[model samples]
Target chain A: MALAKRIIPCLDVDQGRVVKGVNFVGIRDAGDPVEIARRYNDAGADEITFLDITASHEQRDTTYRTVEQIASEVFIPLTVGGGVRAVSDIRTLLNAGADKVSINTAAIFNPELVKEAAERFGSQCIVVAMDVKDLGDGSGRYELFTHGGRKETGLEAVAWARKMAEFGAGEILLTSMDRDGTKDGYDLGITRAISDAVDIPVIASGGVGTLDHLVDGFSEGAADAVLAASIFHFGTYTVGEAKDHLARAGIHVRR
Target chain B: MSKTVAVIDYGMGNLHSVESALRKAGADRVVVTDMPDAILSADRVVFPGVGAIRDCISEFKRLGCDETLRAVIEAGTPVLGICVGMQSLMTRSEENGGVACLDWLQGPVTRFPQDHRDTAGAKLKVPHMGWNRVRQISAHPMWNGIDDNAYFYFVHSFFVPADQCDSVVATFEYGLEGASAVAQGNVFATQFHPEKSHDNGVKLLSNFLDWDGSC
Candidate 1:
């Protein structure tokens, strides 16, 4: 049998509570990170990713505590993204029981962090998360964005993924800012582009409105894994249903 | 009777996850320690690692954990190694320009060939991340409750070639067949991370805790 494609439930955690906003607005508390993670684990999620959306520096330790609590009970791989900046930050997160740390803003500002973090922590735990916005410029190009897709970096998404791979990133978390919260679907173009450009696995994120979107990610986007927030969080679809759908679609998934 | 499982900590990578998993699997007490005395005195030993082999081996030597591990194994204590910890049990590794290992497993760890291609002629990714099905090749206590073709979480670039080893208890396919788990006497090791491998992983950890280190 081949490696089964992963279906990861993304929890946008703010101040230790799970939250999901529409287009980065209208944020509402979903539940506690630990409780929500346990539910997802029971639902047979392949992995759990917690994007620490906590903004205050004083309250940042809450995320670590939340991660530690979940890791104690959740047996699946836990990836914490959103504010990973330094190598020490990665260390603290891993020590707190996070299986992997996703770096987005830091990688663009200081590319060396990726190299050094991978060298120190191993590439398996270093995931380079990229927030991309389709230019719609008819040039069929995607640009990288930072600050939760508020600011643009003008760098080509495909080339950046390749560079991150060369710099020792084990995986890429590619998100589409355009389709995010739109219930449209993943921007398969950029997802496939990044997936084809890098030999490392790419986790397609954002705009997963239905279970079929997950299958499209693996088949059309060539993603090794797919990530969604609201669909699974709001009880519209359980992770089990997603896996069954993918399996029926001829995609191998852990059931 | 109460049991203590010591997860060797040499500042290599995260040991808390393994410690928690072991505790959840029924270990009375789990200690994540770099101290040799505590490790040797524990009822069970877990050697887990991440990152490069060069650094893992160096830390093992610096902390004298290697020597301690040898003594623990000689005393017939059940030992479990995960990921790089499994690689370090080999004779040598091609990682970091060829480094000598503990030589307990009798094989060399080699990187997945850069040119290794899938059926589509596309190169398979290194670090073979995510869940892959593991096929049991031989009977072992570790597979007590685990299925024949159970899926396990694997993440690594280097692996022990299955053909070079005779103690292989489980195997998995990436671009090539590789040893997923091996058992010899009191020591059982796996390239996959059981602590991160969901319920099946919990079953394996529970089995290891109950294992008497026999075939």
Candidate 2:
């Protein structure tokens, strides 16, 4: 059997609670992070990702406690992202039992943080999450955006991905701001471009409305993993159904 | 009688996942420690590592866990090594310009060949970072209740060469065959992360806790 393509359910956590956004806006409460994570684990989620959207410093400890509690019972790979700027942040999440930490805005500003975090923690745990929006110009270019896809950095998406991989990023969490919450599908062009460019694993995030989108991700997009939020969170589909669909479509997934 | 399993922590990488998994697997007392006295006296011992092999070896040296580990194994205590923990049990590794290992197992940890392709001609990814079917090659206590060719979560770039390892009990293919699990006397090691592998993994950890370090 080959390496199974991963199915990661993304949990947008705010102060220990799980939230899901519609098209990156219209926030809706899902449930407790620990409870949702356990359900996903029992339903056969390959991995669980927690995006800590805590807006304050004092409540930051809530993310850690959430991670600690889930890790104590979930028994699956846990990835914590959002608001990770420093190496110490990565360390704290890891110490709280996060298997990997995703860095987005920080990597664009101080690329050295990617290098240093990878060097200190190993590339396996340093995931550089890239939020990209297609320029939509006739030039066929894509620009990287940070701050939840509001501000554009003008940095080329594919090049930045290669640079992050060079800086020793274990994986790239490529989220298409344009397709995100649009429920269309992944940006296959950019996904394939980045996946082809980096030898490391690429996890395609955003714009997954159905299981077929996941198949296209691996087959057409060439992504090593697929991350989704609302579809799995709102009970549109279970992690098991997603895997079953992937398996039936000839994409090897954990059964 | 009560059982105490010492999870050797050398400040390498995350051990809480491993520690909590052991507890969930029914270990009466799972102590994560670096003290030789604590490790050697335990009913079972677990050696876990992550990141660069050089750093792992250096930390072992810094903490003087190298000699302590060797002594614990010699005393016939059941030992379980995970990830870099498994690689560090080898004689040497080709990571970080090559690092010497504990040599408890007779082999070298090497990186997957660059540009390796499977039958589909697709270039296999490094770090093998997902669930892959592990084919059990030999019967061992760890395989109890686990199906042959069961999937486990793995995330690593280097692995023990399947051909050179006589003690390989399980293997998985990623363009080229690599050792998934190996056992020698009281020492059992796995390249995958059992703690993160869900139910199958929990079962394996449970079996490890019940293992008497025997075949």
- What TM-score, to 2 decimals, does candidate 2 have? 0.97
Off by over 4 Å in 1: A21-30, B120-123
- Please give each candidate's TM-score: 0.97, 0.97
Candidates in order, interface RMSD in Å: 1.2, 1.0
- Model 1 chain A is weakest, by summed lDDT over 10 consecutive residues, at A21-30
Cα lDDT, model 1, residue A45: 90
Which consecutive 10 residues in model 2 chain B have the weakest lDDT in total? B116-125
TM-score of chain A of each: 0.95, 0.95
- Which DockQ-derived CAPRI band holds candidate 2? high
TM-score between model 1 and native: 0.97
